[model samples]
Structure formats: C-alpha cells, structure tokens
Target: MTRVLLLGGTTEAGRMARALADAGVDAVYSYAGRTEAPVAQPLPVRVGGFGGVAGLVAYLRAEGISHVIDATHPFAAQMSRNAVEGCAAAGVALIALEREPWQAGEGDRWTHVPDLAGAVAALGEAPRWVFLAIGRQNLSAFAGAPQHHYLLRLVDPPTDPLPLPRAEAVIARGPFDVAGDRALLKDHRIEVIVAKNAGGAGAEAKLVAARELGLPVVLIDRPLVPERRVARTLGEVMAWLDG
Candidate 1:
C-alpha cells in the first residue's frame, strides 16, 4: 500500500482523507491541534504540528511518505510553506487542496479589508454593534473600536481577555442555521459583521444571515500562499493522486 500523509484541519481535509482511503492508499491524517474536538474523519489521525520544516522532513523520510496533501486553513501560511519545503527535502509528492473563497453577490454589503486590523479600522465610530466571527485567535484588534459593542462567536473561550467595553462570547460550532443566525443578529442589534473568507459550509450561514439582513460586513481576505500544485476539489485531488 502507498503511504500518504494528509495535513488536515479544514473541512475538506476529512473528505480528502476518506477519498484517499477509498482508493486503497494508506493515508494518515494530521491536524495542528488547534481545534477543540475537531470533527472525526475516517482514517488514522495525528494531532499537533510536526515541530517545523526539519521535523516534518524527518517524519516524511522515516515514514516512507510517498505523497503529501495540504488541507490546512488558508491562514495557515507558515505550515503551508513548511510543507512545500519539507516535501522538497524528502522528495515526496505534495499537493494543496484549496477551495474558492465566497464571493460577494447582489444585496451583499461587503467591505473588503486586507487583514484583521484593517477590518477594525474600517469600522468608524458610530456607537455601532458588530458581530465578530473572525475566530478566537485575533479579537484584540476590535479593542480599537471601543465605541462599538461586539458579539464574538468562537468554538473555544478566548485565552486573552477582550478589551472591548461591551462584548459577549458565543461558544458554538457551525455550519450555523440561517434562522438562528438572523435571530442572533437581530437580538444583538448588530449593524456590522466581521468574518474571514474561510470558505465552505462550516459557519457559512452567518454570511447568509448577513445577506438577508442587508447588514454591512467587513470581510478579511485570505492569506497569500506559496506557489504549489493545487486542487480545487476532492475529485481533482483524486485525479492528481491517480496520475
């Protein structure tokens, strides 16, 4: 059996692992230990980072890894780059599974910003209410918008204390329900929402809710990735594997 390692954390990561398993490939799924009980996939799994590039290279060579599929989050720039370098060092096949980001449509009020700080800067002082869906890692930027109240939703409790005067945390995972989202928006009296373009159905209903409410959204663009062999879908990844 061919040995494949899947660097997983994204939703499609699980699917990609299953796809490889179905094709009779001996695949091992790896996660970055970021999530609290990430959804289980149908393969042997390893959690936590592989130290760095050197450690990953050692793992690749020692395990006789034939191929590597990077399915980490778009913001995981460091790991993605490490994979590219590590694969080269070990002479292993590498592919990136990246999905298209959600695009703004008619009735979608979007203000595209370069980063999280930029997203906060876009919110002017207006005694506003905002829904911060940017996850647990980077909520400190919102502290600058003290005039605004924020409704922060995260899977885990934030490690650092929030600087906002008025803020609430909702512990939940999604693909959220559009109706429930709409209610939360209405209940919080949110005028603006901040979200990252982490594509796919997981936590996507908030976008739908924002669209329905006609609420303005501050969308953070995805981080840039290094040049790599990319596949937009699982089928495409499977095809690459077959080839």
Candidate 2:
C-alpha cells in the first residue's frame, strides 16, 4: 500500500525511477514539463505542476500517495518547497534526493558566488570572452554585465536572439566530454566560465576542462530549499522508503 509520488527532472530522478520500477514499487513520476522532450522514465509519468500546494494535496489524497520523493533539479527550490508543504499537509512521508555540491580541487581557478547577482557582479566591467554554461533560464542575469562576450552552450536553439550585446549560442545535448569541452573553450577564446554548481558527471566536464585550461570560473551557489528529510544516493532513497 506504499504508493508514492516522485517529483522528478534531474538525471538522478531517472535512475531512481528505474530502480523503483525494477523493485515493483507502485510510484508515479511528476515532471515540471520544462523540457520539450524529456528522457522517458520507467515509472508512470505525469506532466506539469500539481497547480500548487493545494492541488498537490488533492492529487496525493486522490491517488492515495503514501510517500513523496523530491528529485527535482538543485535550483528548483520552489517545487521542493511546495512538495515539503503539500506532503506535510497530506501527512505523507517525504524525502529529498539531493546531489552533493561540487568542491574546488587543486589547480582550479574558481570564484564562488552566493547567487546569480553575485555571479554577474564577479564578471566586472571590463570585457572578457566568457562561457555562460548556466542554462537559458538564468541567462538574463548576464544583461547586468554586458561588457563581457558570452559563449552559450544550450540544449536547443533560442527562438529569440540573446539579450547580451556580444554573445553566441551553440545548440547541443550534454554528457559532455572533457576533450570536447576543452576544444570548445579554446575555439571560443574563452577567458572565463560562468556555471551553476550543478554537481553531476553529465555536466561536470566543463569544470574539469576549465581546470586543465587554467580558466577562472564564476560558480553560482545552489538555492536553499525548505528543510526536509534528504538522501544523497539512490540506495539511501530506497532505504528511506523501506524504513
């Protein structure tokens, strides 16, 4: 009778879905529907939000969801907060699957900023060739630092032209390799990198390549979400469900 609702979007969420389905757990995956074509999940999937906290509570009750797992992107603080509130109201067990943040290693040139505004300010007034790898959603912040020339690597081509005065975008999917990333930086004549601290192997090669090229990175910190039970690994999440 342990039916579950999984708030999913990240790569880790896909892993958890496979594990849950293989274990024969009755669960449904909820997607925010941001991506045009998301990777298919192993579990039954629902697209879009649950309206908000009120709609989420109704869905949980109607579906008889006994547990809630927040496996959204690290920056998706709003969804995480809604899940915490909705699950608590429904009196269901809730757990968050959060990835560990990336740490600075030896030979790394990094400028750690608390938020997007901080990242923008770190770029300074003087023009520099920059790689903006933080995704399209937050690219607007760079409007504040127009002096820098930005090279954007994105999943899909932007319908509208970039907001920046001097910027270009390359459309491609990730699971990026260090060698390719190195060449990209070199080709772009990149002077610095601006990235969100989205710690995962799939999108981590840029950081590795930056270190190899001795490029300075402006890393935006993850936003704080509502406090809740959190599991760092898929095994830990499984244990929480069994507990």
Candidate 3:
C-alpha cells in the first residue's frame, strides 16, 4: 500500500510524474489550478487547492497517501508550506524536488531583489520598456510604477483586462529557446527584465537572452519555505521513493 501524492506544477513535476508511472507507483498529481491548460500527465491528476493544512491532512489520511513529493515551482511558497505542515500532521514522509537558484554570469547586468515588492522598487522612476517575465498573478503590484511599458508572456491570454495600463500580453508557453527569447526582446525593444528566480532549464532562456543583449534584469529571489528534505533530480526523487 504505497499510495503517494505528488504536489506538482513545474516542468520537473511533469518528468517526475512520468517516472512514477513507468515505475508503476500509485501516485496522484496535484495542480494549483493557476494555468488554463496544464500539461497532461501519466498519473491521476487533481486540480485546485486542499483548503489549507487541515484540509490537506484530511486528504492524506483519507487517501492513505504513504508519501508526498513537493515538485512545485520555487516561488510557490504557500502551497509548499502547507504540504510540509500537512504531511507532518499525517505522519507521511515528504520530500521536495527543488532546483537550485540561478546566479549572475559574465556579461550579465543583474540587480538582485529579495521579493516582488523589492523588484517593483528597483525599477526606478524613469520610464522604460520592461519585459515582465514573472507570471500574471502578481502583475497588479507593478501598477504603482505605471510609467514603464510592460511586455508579458503568459501561458494563456488574459480573460479580463490586465492590471497595468501600459502592459501588453504575448500568449505562449515555456521550454522557450534563447534565440526566440532574444528576438522577442529585440522586437519588443525591452530595456530591462523583471523575473523571479524560478530555477530550471525550461524557463532560463529569458536570462540568457538578457545576457546576450546586455539588458539589465531586476531578479526577484525565491520565497523561503519550511525546511524539508530536497532532491535535485529525477533519479534522486525516484531513489527516495524506493527507499
């Protein structure tokens, strides 16, 4: 009876799901329901939240989930924290599949900020063309600095009007290449980039594109999550499950 729950939303989570299926592990993939169309996975999938720590604990107990793997995006602090608390209460083992944060490289001009608000503050008073690589959820925070024009790349087109007055949307998905991102920056005439330090190969193209074009990026650091066991690769997560 090795039922497991995989808290998922990142590219890494997709890979982990496939591995779990191939291994014939009984697991459920859970999405936060932020995206309109999430990628198909091999395991049974559940969308939306589990209410909170109490709800998550109830689910784990009722489903007999023996283990939990938190393969969510680094910036998804709230869900990650809830998972930690829920698993502890349910007496289930939990491990996080987390990627390392990106670091500044040669030829890159980066201003590091602790969080989203700091990123907004870093974008000084002067008006400029900015590539807002952070997702659509936190776009309203930028309204305070309405002087600059923003280029937003989203997984789905906005159903309602965007929060920013000077913002335009480009509907697309990631696993994006550097050439395409470079062309996007050129075409949009982006002078700076505002992005979260969501570390992974799939979404690193924008940083690479910024480096090649000599653009300054205001990088926002990942939020702190409760301490939990972490695995950096698919092999490691599989090993943990086996153990």
Candidate achieving the largest TM-score? 3
Question: Tens digit of lDDT per residue, candidate 1, span 105-149?
Answer: 889999999998889888987878889888777776777778888
**Which lDDT value does model 1 have at 157?**
75
- What are the models' TM-scores? 0.93, 0.96, 0.99
In model 3, which runs have C-alpha deviations exceeding 4 angstroms?
Answer: none
Whichever of 2 and 3 has more lDDT, that candidate is: 3
Candidates ranked by TM-score? 3, 2, 1
> Which candidate wins on lDDT?
3
Q: Which ten residues in a row have the lowest lDDT in candidate 3?
A: 234-243
User: Candidate 2 at residue 237, lDDT?
Assistant: 92
TM-score of model 2 vs. true structure: 0.96
Q: Give candidate 1's total backbone clashes.
A: 2
Q: Write model 2 residue lDDT over 1-243, tens digit each, in one string.
A: 899888898889999999999999999999998777888999999999889999999999999999998989899988999989999999999999988899999999999999989988898888999999988888888898888899999877888878888889998787899999999999999999999998888889999999999999999999988889989999999998998
Write model 3 residue lDDT over 1-243, tens digit each, in one string: 789899999999999999999999999999999999999999999999999999999999999999999999998999999999999999999999999999888999999999889999999999999999999999999999999999999999999999999999999998999999999999999999999999889989999999999999999998999899999999998888888
